[model samples]
Target: MPVDQPQPAPPVPPVLPADVELRSPRPEDAEAWSRFLVAAQRDTYGALLPAAFGDDDLAASRIAALESAFAEPGDAARRIAWRGSAVLGVASASAAPADWEVALGLVPAPASRELDRLYVHADAHGTGLGHVLFDAVVDERPHYLWLIDGNERASRFYERRGFRHLDERVSTGPSWGHIPMHRMLRG
Candidate 1:
């Protein structure tokens, strides 16, 4: 008889804290949202795209854009993760624009949706806030997103949730110091 080999334990999923709540963006949230986004981006992408984060004017412009988007969300659906009064993370999804598809050389699908943004504060990383925010926006449907080319942590998270690289790339232009990004899709 062959000896039995020990099997590895299944990976454990992170558990969201009971106090956390997810809600739609409100006008009152603009300032906190802006600060959270700046801090989160600094923690997440500062090194990968230094110039963008280092520029105060650029950061201000981005914050203004975020506030404007919150006020007039248009076709996008957004969610903000909160723990009491603190903003923990944010996410949004919207119909993939035809121009974006064309630019990426992708054949547009009628139901194609884009995961516009998903940012979790560093304090919430291990508390399952990311997963909660992700599911709240684009749970398991065919959707796509762009990520910084070398974001290993986000890549692994998306890969585990069924997203795969489409081998397509884009640039953020000079405003962002020409940071490179790759597309990922889940179908």
Candidate 2:
């Protein structure tokens, strides 16, 4: 008789902390949202960005922009993940604009949506916050997003969520240190 071989256990899915809350962006969250976004970006892409990217002026500018956006009526649907008073992550989506389709050489679809921003604080990684935030902003419809060229972690996350890369790559311009990013799409 042959001995039985050991079997490996299946991977466990991450769970969101019970206390965490996911909600729409509010005017009062502007400062927290801006700070969280900048910190998350620095943690994930500081090395790939220019020195000026970490300057106080840039942070202040981001805060101002977020404040204005939060106060204004906008097309984007945004969600912020929070744990008590702290922001844990954010995600946003909007209908793809005509200009964006033209630039990407993509045929316009009425249901096409753009995943604008999805950032999670480093502390929230592996806690399922990112997945929750993503699902909160987007659904099973066709949507697309741009991923930074070298962010392997994010690439893996998106790939596992069914996003596939396109041949097109674009520069983010001077504001983002001219970083190259590629487009990914999912239906």
Candidate 3:
């Protein structure tokens, strides 16, 4: 079974509440942002990969990762959707001159951007946070990102936005029981 999966939820709405604010990550936000990522991962992947949740090493790794992503004030250029003080969603992409990562062979493309990650809390799912976050780093052009195979709803959402699945796939790291994930691309 896949280790990283989100439970079923209603479709995301096209509109977001007016109070929702979209912006980039701030330096001081490291701690809250780390908590949000961990919580988000747990909410999405807990059921699929229960063992990973109990692994303190994995939890620390995730936190350290966010710290690295937010290491510099403007390093990753991460964007966030916030509702007042709480984080609603997050999105980010690497610099262009890109190469999409795959399991067997790399999906190479010149100057094609790639989505690093995009996640929205389930509570904010129907509030258009996904779309808001996605649009921050992606338009309708060519790009790709890996999606956990078990996250059908997210895969469908990517499909709705014109991302098509490639034939290749990969797995989560060793601790994840080698769950499969599909690579989706848009052009």
* C-alpha RMSD by candidate, in order: 4.4, 4.8, 10.1
**Runs with alpha carbons beyond 4 Å of true place in candidate 2:** 1-15, 54-65, 71-74, 98-111
Best by lDDT: 2
Local lDDT at 25 for model 1? 93
Q: Write the per-residue lDDT of candidate 2 for residues 1-187, one digit (tens) a residue.
A: 9999999897665677889888889877888877777778878888778777745534667667777777773777899988899888989898784475577565653347888789998887887888888888888788888788988999999998889988877787676788998788898
Residue lDDT tens for model 3, 64-109? 7656667663434478777889888878877543332434345453
By TM-score, is 1 or 3 better?
1
* Model 2 lDDT at residue 84: 93
Candidate 1 global Cα RMSD? 4.4
Off by over 4 Å in 1: 1-15, 50-74, 98-111
10 residues in a row with least lDDT, candidate 2: 102-111
Go through the candidates in order and give each one's C-alpha lDDT: 0.78, 0.80, 0.71
Give the higher-TM-score candidate: 2 or 3.
2
For all candidates, the clash counts are: 0, 0, 0
lDDT of 3 at 23: 76
Structural similarity to truth (TM-score) of each candidate: 0.75, 0.78, 0.73
Candidate 2: count the clashes. 0
Pairs clashing within candidate 2: none
